[model samples]
Target: MRIPLSDDNGHQYRDLNGNGVLDPYEDTRLSPEERTEDLLGRLSLAEKAGLMFQTVIEVGPDGDLVETAGRISKSPTSEVVTGKHLNHFNVHQIATARQAATWNNNLQELAETTPHGIPVTISTDPRHAFVDNAGVAFSAGPFSQWPEGLGLAALDDLDAVRRFADVARQEYVAVGIRAALHPQIDLATEPRWGRQAQTMGHDADRVSEFTAAYLEGFQGASLSSTSVACTTKHFPGGGPQKDGEDAHFPYGREQVYPGGMFDYHLKPFREAIARGTAAMMPYYGMPIDLTVGGEKIEEVGFGFSRQIVTGLLREELGYDGVVVTDWELVNDNHVGEQVLPARAWGVESLTPSQRLAKIIDAGCDQFGGEECTDLLVDLVENGEVSEARLDESVRRLLLVKFRLGLFDDPFVDVDAAERIVGRADFRRQGFEAQAESTTVLVNREATLPLASSIRVYSENVRPEQVSEWAQPVATPEQADVAVVRLLAPFEPRDDLFLEAWFHQGSLDFPPGLVHRLSRIAEHCPLVVVVTLDRPAILTPLVPFVSALVADYGSSDAAVLAALRGRIAPRGRLPIEIPRSMDAVRASRADVPGDTENPLFPVHFGLTI
Candidate 1:
């Protein structure tokens, strides 16, 4: 299907629908709303159904769309784009920026041959961070690596936040990712939650400020061709998961709010809406008897709750942006070797068609992590779902595509992509931020700012890497100062879909590790650094070390620079470090900093 060209006033216009004449949707001169209405009117029921489904996709080494070889859905990209009519995809695992750009161009070329010439909109989770969770976010890899979201919060500077987002926006655009499935605005209220590293912090006001800044940086003052549209999620907040488990598995499906702070969790989302975030995503965790505005809402996942999605987010808040449900809500998925059940928490008893209908009724526009457009088409044809309802969602989805300028030109400069991604200047900025984000928790007797000539024995720091500033010693007794790096403690679990990647459960260190650290401390002045994904209970181990530092995905070089005084440690605690597991169990899951005698309160940091 070749797009016809029309000549007018020395300019050319594309007949996107190959209709031989110019249609309103093909005219770049018209407003996005006008074009969306025209295109919505022209699309068939099947095409509209295709616009409603957004699922994960993979690109092969040759920059061609390929089937993913995992437990996740492996729909052929060609079939999904042509046969099924899906234009939205969440891409994963491309080798480099050049490869990603080539893949994106190939995908757009495929879409151009469609009857409507609807250019595909590719989205991705956060990919600029160091942590690599297959089920959540990807590693920096070939892109400039920055500190995690928690580290950004630790810096507590809006300008720095803006810079980070702008750099990320440029990188994403270079690789042809029009939509960012990130800027997770959920406040880190529960210290044990595994996803806290992706949040700003525990304070509502602070998180709200960062949320607005992030949207401004990614989408700019307003969305345009140069901007990467941001999806602020998980809507109404997803931080209060019961027992700190994620909602990806059946065991982690429940979200409890014992402190009656549901409204508090919604504050950042309210800010995100006001900032004009392009889209929103509801988490998979079902709220357990959550009450709002003196009325008790039903116990269901946010994606399936009419009161929460329609009554609260739509009616009360007046947000009209696209609401995409969190991944795999309608069908079970294979995550690693384990088979994870569909995260249809409240609607578990409903059939797949019934669940799809309920999600539409709940005011959601698109289904994330699902490729089953045929089911939606079947429902519309059978009168299970009205065509008008489908139009409502298609209209919103089309508006986003038009606003992103994807319908006009969706290609990228492959050579420029290689130049812009992980460039020297960008890498330098990321390293500086990583160093600035290193939080000094304790510095008794001014032990830090150690001389560069001191003999150093390191536990986790690579000897060759630390040799830049200090003499490397084999044992603690042979060194003047002993520096050690350890990850925050987590209870290991073997479950579905790379559950081990998540640092959940108890935060206490094992007795053997504690004894080893104490033994090293007795031999020399000990300096300890912990990479925090969650707030580890450090009261038992804090007594042994002379200096304590906290890092959120900083490189080894950045950590050494902070200790050597080449970089100042200015970061603060984004989430509270509880005194013990007992206090964490007693604290309210929805409340921040409610633990009794926490080891370190929110925003606690020290600087020499």
Candidate 2:
């Protein structure tokens, strides 16, 4: 066990400085601001610079510290913490709940041995969701699995959203995870936007209300030791991509406002700001030819745009929280065959050092997915970036750690972690939520509420799970009813590293898919469940299918439960199902509910 020291008032504290005395920065009685001030005064320029980069770090097999570099993490865990002094990390890929807690303890033990003894603040993308996109979110490996963000929006229940968030917080805190890199409030205004599965939906008012509940759930009444600080993200909106392409790649860098509704996108963020979110992240997309409030906004990415970051978010909106940039805006990522260049967007011509200067000047507090503290230290030493400016960010960062009680104790009980994470009650609630969020778009002649005695032909569903509800047949021709699950269509691209993971491009079902489903429909009364990661064009299959349904990251059991009428499908269309791809092309990027003749409008659903 570790030893501690006591001050004059007999309040015990960690001897963080290792000088055998209680330092002002280590005092538990002092306010976070007071502790931050004392710590800021003591930190060297290099140490302060390290706090600005929140990078990825992987755990070793059996929950040990990673001694060597991995595919995603640039350096080993020890190098980043002890050598480079980076404390903030986004952890990925844990085998079990115990492993996660052990890894965190090992990491904090390492941090304790460092010069300042600053505890690491671990953050994660939405891990409870079913979609496992490495660039966006991970799978629910050891946590209770819930539907994606769109499913939560489909439920349209503020109480349910709050409950999910609160449960997620408990699971996260158990594993020593202190920050949530989510509650992604970006509205799905653009139908073909690839990242819509993680968004709340297309409506501004509903998204705003949910955003408040989400913040309350994660951060609790306020950010405390038990609470998980949420980084409500993609500021100034990332949904209005030009031609519906993502900003991760160079070709998709432009974010247009053709409908001139730029202000409309900021509605949810206004709620996030009002709810006191712990951090905010600017997106990679650069606004194109945009003028706001009679002034022309600069055509730089929001991460490097002072007009968006400092002027709009900080000064205009009066948001004083830590502003973090989207990942890897300053450095190129080259992992084996996969190569992703830095997302500098409009300022692509500038060097990495110059880009770093610009990000700081734009008033960002941290650089996401970056580990170039040496570059930042050099910038400050060269007078390109001021030490005073570094202090401004470091103060905010340290205060968060202090407020989280990381200074008091960063360790968690490994036993408690195993018990609390993915508890039986939590899993039951998640499965129920999944079933409740399944939207019945078209059910002709009372085709749904399937009888348990009916013969079933399953596609993209587990045979054993299907056997639980109805007789599972080998082929559609052998069954009385056919159940097929299809993912919303997207144009296939293998050029970019993370492009395959992002379900982008066209929403129209490919010609081959239509032909295949047509064949299956002929064999029996078809029951098609389309996973709506993006708003899909369902016009071709509308006439042929007996029952049409939509799901956002639900399990086979959950979907089957709804199909069997064990649970009712209460979800509605969070976004409209467009009539055709032509309608998608003609619609404005910034406008919601703009699809000309949608097959199914937003909030459209059928009950049995």
Candidate 3:
């Protein structure tokens, strides 16, 4: 199990390729750029092609390598790493910190056996938050749990955001997760968009400020060994979703800029590039007859648009970091009986191979959630994509690996991972953040900070946790007050793989639910708390409810603490709460704070 070491002038280095002499790429003292160039020359065409794709890889029970392909992953871990020669992977879940460390070490061992011994660079979506949307993000498992991204935005504290990111970095680094697929900087301009919870609010300036702190926290001052390279995502802004529909499906592929505020969304990205973000991810949405600065944008997905990726991001912004496409842009995803088609958008007619070639031509470095090294290799052999072009991307990818110190040592200490991940201090801080992010929107007649002796009729509030605050009654009639918890309403759809998981469509509460809450208010003063994943229309409930509260992602305990004055609510609304669905429809998708006569504007919050 001992990795053989080579020495050159008393400096020992990992003999990655099993060659006796110390290769220039294996030299520890050399700069990343120099080492990248040395390794670039040594790589075969197939090896270089493999570096262009990053796919999903699931860990087996107890950190064992999966022998078979998973539901979402197209190939097993070994087949993708060794056979396909991929070095980057997006890990789905980690059962435990020690197990994650073990899995990472095992994966690196597999990579070490390869011809070049390229260590795998593990990445993950935001996993320190609530909500377990499989394709988007996973819930915290053996990791310190924190509020969702919107909760952090609700707090709007740069120091707090930096602390959270640093904690995440420590946890990720312990388990050998080098890349963080997050800090989703897309402004929540459209209230009905499903992915709004993952973004900062519609304010460009605040989002831009938070972005600098975010990059600083995740990657430190710069991306180094101690850092988790942050991929500030959905570049050129994915906020202006037409009809508030996501671009993951064919129906929601249009990203319109009807307000002619196309440059407005690019504000945070400019900050990201300035802060030295490790990577960028373009959204699946294609501009729909959109014009930016008097230039008509090609009606292709951002991943396939040369004007956007090459001309705008690369040339104009001068960003040389890796550019990864959103998931499944070239291949259709097969989930059970249903098939989630590729998000080719304007270029849907192109073949899978053609799509890959175009993405490369568009100046992308790697394919997200894809494993098609053979296809890329064929493209090079058939003269569609030149090998020199592949080097440009591969070189960037290798530089990131080198700069991250992966080439020096990829293995992690299993014992250290267990001790550092989900430590008591980290968990306590996360719980406090959850409590602090509880935004009290309406407190009519000072209804909150309720007496502990008061009898409470609870709905959706946990009976055991509610008992700690006040007496829990079976019916509203037997109680002095009613405490109810509700999620912001969204129209349900189950067409695609992750469609149902994403809370898309209408933001209006159902008539029946509103009627039930109104009836409860007649018995006693009602305290209704709704989790505002997206800004929900609260016009109907505002009249009937005695007290209205909003939270991004909070636990029952956190809410109870805020209600009982144990922990005061410090959160403000990050985005406006629309008065009605009519106002939402009339507002420009690209413009911020454009809703007419909003019930509660951005940064609106109250104390008990």
Candidate 4:
């Protein structure tokens, strides 16, 4: 076993390099800059290359590292941690909090056996929400579930945002997750964009306010042992998808700004940087022939554009934090039977090695969803990419690891993780938030706060949950009122690896579903609740319903409680519901609240 050296004040520090003497990086008292520089000096080419790659990893049921088959490349945890020297990972699925904590400890123990004894820094995408798209966000399994990011924005409460982040931070630190890969902060300028639910909203001011609150809650007043470092993402914003197609596919690669509102998208990111966000992730979309501040930018994806990543974000904005690219920028991804092309976008002509070199040249410190350290090492050894350049990124990566207190103690209390995750109080808060965030857009004739004794016919609501609030009847004709729940509409597509999770395409309801709802409305006083995953065209249904409620991933009981007036909904519309698809097509993607004759303006919510 390795022993620690004691200082004059009795504070012990681990001899990480096993050099038989205290090194600056091994000393806890030294400044992060000094420690980073010292660690950079001691690392080999292979070790530094490992620091540049941050890829996805899976945990087995018994707390052992396992490889996932198909699309997600599997690297054995032991080989990746010790042999490959990779210390950063984005954990995918885990059975339980205790198992996750045990798995983390196992990974850290393996790292201790390595030459430098570097503890792994585990990170995750947003996990405290209801959405569970593998490529986007994960569901709140074994954790408290809240509304999606847009749902939080709909509440328009800064304190609520802070509370959610704080609770998530506590749960994450307990499970040995040191970094958060989210709090997207991207404006939902394009209503049909698949990832809008992950954003704060379309308004720059509100997005800015929430961004600061989110960062503060995750990082605390300052980063410490208890804090989880936050990565404010899709940098410079990613809400301007052309034709509402995501940049994950070839057709959706272009991010257009037809309204000349490029700077508007950058507003929230500026606020995040001011609040001291630890890291930033550029999006996959390329700015197609757009000009910002009288200067024409290169028509390339943000990950490959030195002008945007280095010039705009690094130099112009004065941000010096770690810059990580979005997934699959270099190599093609295998999603079951389908293969996704590398999102090189404008640089599709370049080889894999050339793409990796371009990312380094763009001033990115780490590559997300990629594990090609060999290519990076080869580039450095061949003199194509200089050692000094590699050191710059490795230094930044080390600073985050050190700042996160990973070097001191990377393990967690497995028992504590079991006790802390999804605790009763956390669950209560989440449930309460769900009720509070249900937006009541139309409540004509004071129709809400339904009587408990009244007969009610419900559709899409669980029979047990409906029975809790009112008398449930089989037919709409036999009931005093009909309560129906509907999801926002989307055109489905067949694609590889979690692409189906993205609810993209037309927001208009299909004819059959529309007819069913219209027929239900004809029978009795109808109360309709629509979950707004994306802004839906509600012109047809709006006229038929007696009451209209909007939700973003709330539980059935929470919706019933809100309807019963047990908890009043304070949520407002985060995105405007367009009158028709024509208006949506005519409006510019980069501009917010531009829909012509919107059915309901943003911030439109009512309470009886």
TM-score, structure 3 vs. true: 0.99
lDDT, candidate 2, 315-375, per-residue tens: 9999998998899999899888989989999898999999999999999999999999999
Q: Mark the regions of model 1 whose C-alpha exceeds 4 Å error after superposition.
A: 1-6, 67-73, 335-337
After aligning candidate 1 to the native by TM-score, how far in Å is the CA of 500 from where it should be? Answer: 2.0
Task: Please provide, for model 4 over 1-608, each residue's C-alpha lDDT reduced to its tens digit, 9 standing for 90 to 100.
Answer: 33345454576787677776678888888987888888889888899998888888788787876744323645677767776788999987766998899899888877878778888889998888778887888889998989999889998999999999999999999999989999898888888898888787899998999999999889987778888988888988899999899999888899999998889999999998898888899999999879876889888889998988899999999999989899889999876577778899999999999999999999999998888888998998899999999888888889988888888888899999999999999999999889989999888788897878899999889999988767999998898999998889998887755567788899999988878888887888899999988899988888888899999989899988998889988899988989999999999999999999999999999986
Q: Is candidate 1 or candidate 3 better by lDDT?
A: 3
lDDT of 3 by residue, 406-492 (tens): 999999999999999999999988988988888998888888887888899999988999887678899999999999999999988
> Clashes in model 2: which pairs?
none
Candidates 1 and 3 compared: the better one by TM-score is: 3
Q: Cα lDDT of all candidates, in order?
A: 0.88, 0.91, 0.91, 0.88
Model 1 C-alpha lDDT per residue in residues 333-380, reported as the tens digit of each score: 865457778899988999888889999999999999888888898988
Q: Which 10 consecutive residues of model 4 have the lowest summed lDDT?
A: 1-10
**Which is better, 3 or 4, measured by lDDT?**
3
